[model samples]
Target: MIKKVILLGMAVFMTGSIAMAQHGGPRGNKRGMAKDLTPAQLATLQTKKMTLALDLTAEQQSEVLRINTEDIEARQAEHEELKQMRLENDQSTNRAEAQFARQKARLDSKIARQEKLKEVLNAQQYAQWKKMNRHLERNRRQPPQ
Candidate 1:
């Protein structure tokens, strides 16, 4: 009877282990881990003054705001699509490709935005803006430790 009980317990334990393994983790929900931002939302967040650090005249500010809003929406849409591709692909190579594409697009967009911003600034204002952007970039790059 004791031997039979031991065997039954072992079978139950094995079945539970197999079930857990197939289900993956306690939560078992992929939706929570997926990227959720729409392009419009990301653009709105990006155009906010805290991140841009530019000093502008009223006209310059309006122009910059328009540029930022447009750029952010475009980039955010591209980013969201890339993120969806990454999530759908299980292969590391595919994920890497998606990431690379997303990064390239982002860099190109940033360069384009910089050029547009230049058209909106005088020499002194542009210099100040560059300085502020450099400071912001430096701050962003620091390791949290």
Candidate 2:
């Protein structure tokens, strides 16, 4: 009976570990490993995807690449800033104010990006880009099926 119990416990532990390894474990595949990518790599990949989806011309592609690079670099900087802010834990700062500021900044950035895209893309392409953004936002909010 002792031997059987030991074997059963070992089997359960092994199964749990295997499941963890397959499902991204603690470190997580949550970012799809995108957190590991450099800003330039992210920009290039995003621009290429947009080009493919929008059938962008050479000029438009270049413009979009620049926009993507700027956005990626800005986001990286903001991420680092937020990391530092979290580390500081300033008791003087209001958490609600910080949250509101962060959200407002993000919205402002999006609005600026949309304006830039509008200047670069035709009406049809702009519409398509908006549609693509909606789809991406939807997917980001939902867990994998």
Q: Please report the TM-score between candidate 1 and the true structure.
A: 0.57
TM-score for each predicted model, relative to the true structure:
0.57, 0.81
* Cα deviation of 70, candidate 1, in Å: 1.2
Error of 2 at 129 (Å): 0.5
Residue 29 shift from truth in candidate 1, angstroms: 23
- Give candidate 1's error at residue 55 in angstroms: 4.2
Distance (Å) between predicted and true CA of 90, model 1?
5.7
Name the candidate that leads on TM-score: 2
Over the stretch 1-145, how does candidate 1's per-residue lDDT look in tens digits? 9999999999999998888777664566443443475545544554456235555567776677688778866865785676776687646566567679778878898899889988998887778878878987997799632
Task: Score each candidate by Cα lDDT.
Answer: 0.71, 0.92
Q: Per-residue lDDT tens digits of candidate 2, residues 1-145?
A: 9999999999999999998889778677867788989888998999999999999999999999899999889888999999998898765878899889999999999999999999999999999999999999998999765
- Model 1 Cα displacement at 33 (Å)? 18
Shift in Å, residue 14, candidate 1:
40
